[model samples]
Target: MSEQWVETTLGEVADWSAGGTPKATNRSFYDGGDVPWAIISDIQNGPLRETAKCITPAGLDAIGGAKKVVPEGAVLVSMYGSVGRSAIARTPMATNQAIARGVVGTQVSPEYLFLWINAHEGQLDQMARGATQRNINKQIITAFPIVLPPAPVQERIVEIIGAVDDHIAALDAEVGALQGVYRAATSLLWGTAEGDEAAPQLLGNVMHLDVVRTPMEAGTTYRLAGVLNAGKGLVDKDEFDGADTEYAAMNILRENQVVMRKLTAWEGPITVVPAGFDGFVASNEFPTFTLADDIAPGWMKHVCRTPRLWAEMQSRVVGTVQRRKRLNPDQLLLVALPVPSRREQEQAAEALDAIEGQVAVIRAEATRLRKARAGLLSGLLDRTIDIESAELEV
Candidate 1:
């Protein structure tokens, strides 16, 4: 530790309090309200600018003295559910009982405190107390130990961290904009309008389900993969290592084949398998399909991800409740699909492929930036790297 730094409890450097929730049965408390009411879900490891729910002045009064509206710049930590998640309030807002607000004094910066709490998230989780659902209280938060650097040093640390985060945010926004353009272009090319001349074709005519199974070889290692909802693409399913018994009868996924989670077809968990993911294994829950000569692989994947197709697939679900609902291969093959000429489908696929390639590049860059930021944060907070050096690097 640096000789200039002092060790102190969070309570000595900040004022701490918790929040509350109003009665949900009261409609007047929420109807047409403009106030931003933050919940545990609203804390996104960054500044809180908006929330999923809002409440009126009456709602604020309903919580009584137990909850208080925190001003802008106050740091908030999730005390329950997702414990240790923290964010700074960008605007005046009220939080639910699960969030703890820390109003730092002149000796500490809110951003620094947020980063500190984030760095010690595992410890915070351990400190939580409960049998069913673990939770931390105001006392635990206030009494938490923290290394206190001078206010100037704290501000410098924030500046270094914020610069990298700002770059990441810009890349995220760009990815979103590119995705929007791709979605609009796909809709225009694939959507059937009233005046369209092309006849709609059954999906079975353009694609056939691939039910090929490859039993896992004993002592052989395989890369397992799964599809993500909302066209997020494939993710390695290494977390299911113990479920190798389940993979014994898993189907083999080939390059350019479209795969979908039958149970989550309504939620759009479908995508085309890239060549990099070829030879991966997926369970029966994920059904793979091969495109016909007339259809483009990329275009077909986008079609399966569209909301219109998802709604149609949902209609084919054959169970009483959501958890039990499933989309069978027979049901999927019968869905109607808009079929444009091969040339038109190719052009649309090309455009979407370009957009997706750009998104992939941005995501890769963001991952690198995050790694660098994590290294820098650890060094700076632990006093292994001096503030002057970090400032110069920034």
Candidate 2:
């Protein structure tokens, strides 16, 4: 650890800058270029490999003063729409104004700073000021207060946490590969593959759906109404504890049941009600179902989510201004399913399940690595541990 504990701003660590979008007026700059242009969309896919758009050399001159490309190792954090999402740059590239470019100092290892920012993710959200479009300008990020530790301790914490990151990344690749397999299998049977017939059938024929109409205790129903950020697979009763019970009068959900939001501000059509919540009552807004024994619930759910089904569902949208799209029970029952042999269905289900399990495990590992990385950053930056000689990863 440095003999003296020092405090500083993020700007002191390195050059903190903002970016600007190149002019859309010029059409020639956007096509066929080696330089990858990254926008807010880049991070949505998880660690980006290549950008969706690229710019030519002329594009750089157009936005001359607006921040330039950061080195491959520098960290970029999304500061608009959603705040505090951080990722390491994999290659030299330009980012849009939605991100704050953080160039770390020699006193701090770049990777260590990334972990620290991640630890302060909640703070990043808290520090943001705008309501309509959340944002943290370069000034806010650069001037943000930060605790510093000796170089050696930063290195050690980084090492320990970085090893976990590598392990998690490996698992992520395997999970992705498995998921690709499942996608291929579905595409083959569903005509989603290239050169296949473009037949989009109704959603009802593939599986069975039953909306729960039962009432819950005390005029209140369960919270597993098949909605939430994580979707309705798992239930957290605490969320339902203080909610109004009058709306809780709905039917109970069962295992292997496919549930969906009949009306929601956000767009989503399907979710699975976990088996544990088998007898739980849902709100009137949710439609619950049971998958036939012959069919794989996983495949059936996939079918319900196909582009074909979504288009058909869109045509069912009614109600002016509010624009509510109701699922026709009869129409849903008539949707055609890709009838594979019972054995193929089981095998496909098992393979898809196995792949999904692997994806879940890798995702869990990624979450843990992120947490460990955060923990180490907090400990090291706060000087919770005295450093004479320490090992950390970057």
Candidate 3:
């Protein structure tokens, strides 16, 4: 550690204050308000521009004199539910009692402080108090230990971390755009005009449920696959114990096969099994399907993801309660689908595949960048990596 570096509490480097909520019974306090009022939900990994709810000046006054408006650049932390979540206020705002505002003083850079708090989230989580819903108080937050460096060094550190974050944000934006394109293409591919001649047929004619259970043997290891809700995709269920004595019957998932979580079919937990996950096992809750030779598995997966199909699946759900609702395979097979010619299906698949491939690459790059940033944060914050040397590279 350099001689110039010092260890200090957050209180020593910034002004500390807590926020409060106005009385809910009074309609005048919140109706047609101008002040942006923040809640714990408003605290994210980045700067907060606006909030879910707003408050009038009378509402602010009702919270009491101490809970004043927090200005832009002030670092705010959630002290109650979702403890340790932090963000910078991009605009003037006031928060509920669950948030603690740290007004950056001349001693420290606001960005540096925000990044440091984010990097040390585990410590904040450890400091939370209570039995039911864990929480931290103003005292705990203000007394939190911080490793301080010179203002110039802090600015350089922020520059290094901020660059990677900006890159990640850009990649995320591109991925979103690509996904929108894919959705639009799918809509075009499935659109039916008044005189369109695409044949409408039952799903059972094009796809069949692959329910052949490959029962687990006594001592053999098997990979488990889980379907993610909301059309996310398949994920390896590493948490499943294949060696458990009470293992149930599981169906084997093959490449290019479509899988759906029966319980969450309404919410769109359907996806095509990509290559390299060929032999994974899935429980009955996740039913697998094999498409006919004429149908493209990718296109079928997208069809299942559509809100129209999801509504049909919801109608087929059979259960007494909402959570218990499950889609019956027989009923699922009876759902209608518009069948296009083989040539058109292949062309649509190719277009969607191109967009999806680009999205996958960008997402993988984002993951790598996040890991690299985490490593840099740890090394720089702990003084394991020389700030001056890192600054030169940046």
Candidate 4:
């Protein structure tokens, strides 16, 4: 520790208080309200400008009046569910009881406290005790240990970390813009008639189910793949021993084949198996399909990501119960989509694929920068590196 630094508890430098939730059954507390009511999900890494839900002045009264509300710039921390998740209120807001609000004193900057809590989130999560819903309390938050540098030094640290954060935010915005461009291109090529010279064809004519069942052998461990909802693509699930399974056989996945979770096909839990996922196993619930020779695998992969196709599949969903509705292979084959010329399909896929490649690269860089930020913050706080003399470029 630096000789000049003072080790102190959070309560010593800030006035902390827990928030409250208004009665849910009462309409007057929430209906047509303007007050920003924050929950655990609203705590982004930076300032929270708005929230998912709102409350009225009556709602404020129901929660115990003005004391429950925290002013703008107040640092808020989650005590339940996502322990240590913190955010600075960009505007005056009231939080639920699961969050603790802190009004910092002159000894510490709000940003400094926010950063400190964020940096120690994992530690806080460990302090939290519970099997199902891990949580902490206002007392734990108030007594949480913090290392405080002098006021100027604290501001310098914030500045150094804030710059990296700004760069990340800018990169994220760039990714968003690129995504918009991708969506615009997708809509132009797939949704419009001008881009597709050929007439639309029923899905059955272009793709057919090819369920390849590989018999499960006892003592053999199998790596499983599951399709993520919202077309996020395939994810590697847990490995399971064949001896533990009741099924005699499992469907094996192949690269370029499309897979869909029959139960949630309406919600877009569909994707094309990528290269690394080939030979992975899935249950029959996730049916695989092979595309016709004329269809470009890349083009079909892009199609699997489209919401319009999902909506069309959704209409075919049938069942007595809403959640139980399933889109079977026979029904999925009936869905129609425009069949662009093979050349056009290849060109469109190449253009969109390039944009996707750029997005992936940007995301990877952003992740690396975040890790660097964490390291820099740790070094500065622990006095391993001096913020004043170090070059701040991230």
lDDT of 1 by residue, 340-378 (tens): 887777766777778889989999998898889888998
Please provide TM-scores, in order, for all candidate models, with all chains considered together: 0.79, 0.65, 0.80, 0.88
lDDT of 2 by residue, 177-291 (tens): 8767766755544432243543544345445667657544553434544454223244445435424565545666777787765563234465566566677666666666676
| C-alpha root-mean-square deviation, candidate 4 | 4.3
Clashes of each: 0, 19, 0, 0
Superposed Cα deviation of residue 354, candidate 2 (Å): 2.3
Q: What C-alpha root-mean-square deviation, in Å, does candidate 3 show against the real structure?
A: 4.6
Judge candidate 4 at residue 40 and give its lDDT: 50
User: Which prediction has more favorable lDDT, 1 or 2?
Assistant: 1
lDDT of 4 at 369: 91
Which run of 10 residues does model 3 get worst, by summed lDDT? 91-100
Runs of candidate 3 exceeding 4 Å displacement: 1-3, 18-35, 55-68, 81-107, 129-133, 191-197, 239-248, 383-392
Segments of candidate 1 deviating more than 4 angstroms: 1-3, 17-35, 57-66, 82-107, 130-132, 188-198, 214-225, 238-250
Model 4 lDDT tens row, 33-63 = 4656665566565676454476555555566
Candidate ranking (TM-score, best to worst): 4, 3, 1, 2
Instruction: Summing lDDT over every window of 10 consecutive residues in candidate 2, give the lowest-scoring window.
Output: 95-104
- Alpha-carbon lDDT of model 2: 0.56
The all-Cα superposition gives candidate 1 an RMSD in Å to the true structure of: 5.0
